[model samples]
Target: MLKLFILLSKSKFGHPTVMFRLISRLMASNKPVLANTPVPVNKSKKRPAWSMYPKLHDKVLEKLKENQLNHTFNPKDEEHSALKTYDTNIMGRFRCYNDECSSPGWGSKVVAITIREFSGNRYNARVYHQRCRECEKVGRLIINKSSYVDRVTYRIKKWNGVNMERPKWEEYSGPPHDRKLCEGCRLGRCKKGKSDDE
Candidate 1:
């Protein structure tokens, strides 16, 4: 808690927490200081349990790194299966992680995680990716023909098809196409067309 307050205060005010920490280290190491007026004490704040795990994130990062090395299952994980990878998409649970999926039902989504492997066994990364909501699977690769280029590649990504309840200048326009197609984009295109004529 005290350390977090110090960190927060130090970050906000550009105060020297590192110097203070160094002074703390020096005091701990029995370094002598001049007997002048002592350093002013800073107020400390208590941090929540999740934030105060004492290098928990570092430990997780270390384990993730070790998993990259040796390519072996963790002996410490006695309970988990030999294959420990997991994802909502692989299990075919495309629903959102939110709890309130029942009352209004869920907007269907295809959610999955992707792991990129490397040869040197140093930096492996796991990324959680959503199967495009519209396509209901991982995104698609599209190829467009360009007269100038041999091949042009584009990616079609699935995005949530939610309708946002915002007012728009589309009041002057007719019925809309796909609802997620923003009114702002349509209005901007129309405004540009009119301005070009004027």
Candidate 2:
């Protein structure tokens, strides 16, 4: 075995030096390389469970859809406090991250919105999307129900399916422009039509 090891080491079979060290260790130790060692535990910390998130998400979506039937309000309107806040804070505020467009990082425009009202006339807007005026890409925006007077403050939970900074409005940027994901752009006659050359 020692002669064979030496012969192998001097040949192309031992091209890798680590193999020689391992083989030498095996020969010198006179025992199995894996013997008696404790199995390693993957001590990765478990994330806190959001068990109710799915049900709550479905409920919110259902409520938003139901409210959409009668709760249509122009995002550009500033008469209603809730709608006004939505307009100023969310609509035409987010910057698009799409590089395909001629002007990436340009602020997006509100294309669709849904609102749900609560006690004391407080409102929560969900399923709202902002479309880039340049490339016509869409990004989802969510507004939380805080208080009637304080509803003006919004936290962006997600943008285009990504977790956002959640605090700063100016930091709110969106996913890459995708016309296919935008209904107005997909169906044609987007707020701003594509250039004639394309």
Candidate 3:
């Protein structure tokens, strides 16, 4: 009986033997190489960039179409405005035209929009100024004339009188001290040493 079993094992019909016992053991431990089965895998679908600014483009167009007035909140509709609060954690609202807005700094108004065509990683929404038509046209013209330096400079300006006057200089220096100070630090850069304020 032992001789018969040895003869059957020695035959080449069952499966081919290979070198490296560990490799052969690993291969043998898996399922047979039948034609039907394959290993399974899972892949998560990525979210689109435009998904973040959902309906923004449409909202702007709709507002424009209706010719909505700027700077005033309408009980009936959504209009363009600067973002005063963009954070999810804070319990506050952000008007896009608010002075603290990081983009397209236009003016301080709750219902006024101060953004146009802002881009994200995968998408962009056209932010717009919510001023009247005349201001909007002039704003665009200035944007066109401005150099890169000036364009960036333009986004920053006085917002809700936060830095209306330097605390120390407000009383002594008086109003309209220097256009340079206003132009250079439209977003409050005059207080050079007070790094802690930011």
TM-score for each prediction?
0.17, 0.23, 0.17
Worst 10 residues of 1 by lDDT: 148-157
What C-alpha lDDT, on a 0 to 100 scale, does residue 165 get in candidate 1? 43
Give each model's whole-structure lDDT.
0.26, 0.36, 0.24
Model 2 pairs whose backbones collide: none
Backbone steric clashes in candidate 1, count = 2
**Candidate 1, residues 1-198: lDDT per residue as tens digits?**
355335435553234534455456546756555434243344333311110111122433343343232231122322222222221111112222222112221221221222222233212112122222332322221211120011000000011122334322112222222212212122232222233357
Q: Which structure among the candidates has the greatest lDDT?
A: 2
Candidate order by lDDT, decreasing, is: 2, 1, 3
List the RMSD of every prediction in angstroms: 21.5, 17.3, 23.1
Pairs that clash in candidate 1: 110-131, 132-158
lDDT of 2 by residue, 1-198 (tens): 555455556654454443455466566867644433332222333321111112233343443343332222222322245422222222333444342334334444323233333333334443334454664555323223222112222221121133334443333346544455444344442333243217
Lowest summed lDDT across 10 adjacent residues in model 3 is found at 85-94
- Identify the runs in model 2 with alpha carbons over 4 angstroms from their true place: 1-92, 107-113, 117-124, 139-198
Task: Give the count of colliding residue pairs in each prediction.
Answer: 2, 0, 18
